[model samples]
Target chain A: MKITCPSFKYWYPRLKSGKLAANDEQLAINHLSTCEKCRKAANAIEALIEDKIQPESDVFFSARLFARLEKSKPSHSVFIFRPVFAYTLLLSLSLFLGIRLGTYFYYQSSIPSENISISEEYAIHSTISGLDVFFQDDFNE
Target chain B: MDENEKFLDKLQSGDQQAFRILVEKYQPMIQAIGIQMFERSEDNEDFIQEVFIKIYHALPNFRRKSSLSTWIYRVALNHALNLNRKNKWKKWLMNGLNLIGSNEQAVPQMPGQIEENAEQREMRRLLNKAIQRLPENQRIAFVMTRIDGLSYAEVAEVMGISEAAVDSLTQRARQNLRKHLSTYYKSL
Candidate 1:
């Protein structure tokens, strides 16, 4: 019963799955007994397949988790600075500032030039009337 | 409503007690994952807490597409993998430093007990390292199926892969582990 490495490989899955025929399983057992390398490989594979060490949780695990959860809970104010609110605030402020600037510019551009010239004429006329009063007083004296 | 749905509803409605119940129910599963995934024992508690915290935040958005257990498995596995990736480099450096500074002779042990225990620990550590070295999907598949005792169908559901895919991944993972362990034992 000469079992090649490839033959062992073929039988290995069946051996692990317990699906190998009784004679084939005996043959594999014989081969493993004679071959130290194959036996070591089999042991290593078994160890790998074995259940891993289960970690034990502390008795207060739930309490600890709750504590941590409480500590990490997001405050209500966190919503105020959320990206959605921040973006909305920025857009509204920009729109308001844009409208205000636009209105100011429109008013500046819409006022007639004649209004400015008429205001200047009123100031000169008032000054001339004051000068006439001074001349009339001098003539009466 | 099912127990999970009721629990989820309470959680979404700001029921702290319900959230605690949820954490209590899943703590062992999360701890199991953390123990397998993390090298440090102390990190398991923190890792489990993080998983539950994530579940808490994500619970409201959880549609009942999968069972709560399956969803929790997915979250735990994903979080563990992410944490494993993020901490890999740091863990390696710390391990290296420990190896350099370690004094094996300082600890007192029984005449034969020390050698046996050391060998066992070494083998376990090597096995863990091999599993960690595997690709993410394969590692998850292997851990879920072998370590966590999940059936292929359950693993497939949690991983969102086909049952056949789970079978293939587990097979490949086993082969890879065998190769790694054989090489490592030969070197030893």
Candidate 2:
């Protein structure tokens, strides 16, 4: 039986590369000898395979790539709060609060109770005097 | 540790020199991919830079399961495929707009104006178009195997497919390319 074009196509490369078994190689070779179309197709396939585009070369490619990398390198200076830093912050805040509250209470206790009572009495007297003046103004009017 | 692992360690530790060496070593491979994927040299250059940048960002989290080359191939291929898809969409949209806006056809190239090298360039362009028209897996397999000269096993590893699968894909790719080239050649 004659090999179909598709079968020839599939096995042609294998035969060329010597990947096919001897029997398969013989079969492909026999087919190629008789089939003008497959032969032309094979030539075209080889030409296509050989016709690779040359890769353009830049001598300064590495330099430019590195320059770009250097330019675009993300900044590492962003503050990342570590557990230690967080703990230290918490400890400092607690210490500050403790000191502030302690100082407030100590100052509160340090002022004599009699002085506070005197200030309260003065505040009440001042309010009374201000009210009396306001009422006297109304009466005068 | 092996050389790849050591190099990876240095890369992970933010060693710029290691990064330079890595880029120097792999630039050609990445360029090959870029050149295969893009038509314009500038586009290839930009694509290469983008691939390297992606590799740079991805290195820190790399689990070191695959060889660096394989991983790089995977990344380069993925990026090229995505860029190609976007470019195809853009080209289609532009072509549609052109169709609507003007009936004036593009000027044909004069035979006298064609240089000796023009035929080769035209053939290469046609071949690239044929390759681009290939299905994703077949194109990848064919390009990796034929253009980049990767072995079937290596291509399979990069593509995450069995070696036999790569062989089949590449066979199909070659068949398709041959068909396309034959049709083009006959038309001429």
**Top candidate (TM-score):** 1
lDDT of 1 by residue, B82-142 (tens): 8887887766787787853552212211112345565556666667667778988888888
Q: How does each model score on lDDT?
A: 0.71, 0.72
Candidate topping lDDT: 2
lDDT tens digits by residue: candidate 2, A52-141: 433334567778888898899766653546666778888999999999899778756665666566545444445546665555455456
> Residue by residue across A34-86, what tens digits does model 1's lDDT show?
98877876776686566553434456888777788889987777775988899
TM-score of each: 0.63, 0.62
Decoy 2 TM-score against native: 0.62
Q: After superposition, how far is residue B119 of candidate 2 from its true place, in Å?
A: 1.9
lDDT of 2: 0.72
Cα distance off (Å), candidate 2, residue A5: 16
lDDT of 2 by residue, B1-188 (tens): 88767878999887988988888877866776775666544567788898999998898998878988899999999999999989888778888778546423222221233364554556566667777889999988877776434677888999999999998887788767765665555322
- Give the TM-score of candidate 1 (chain A): 0.45
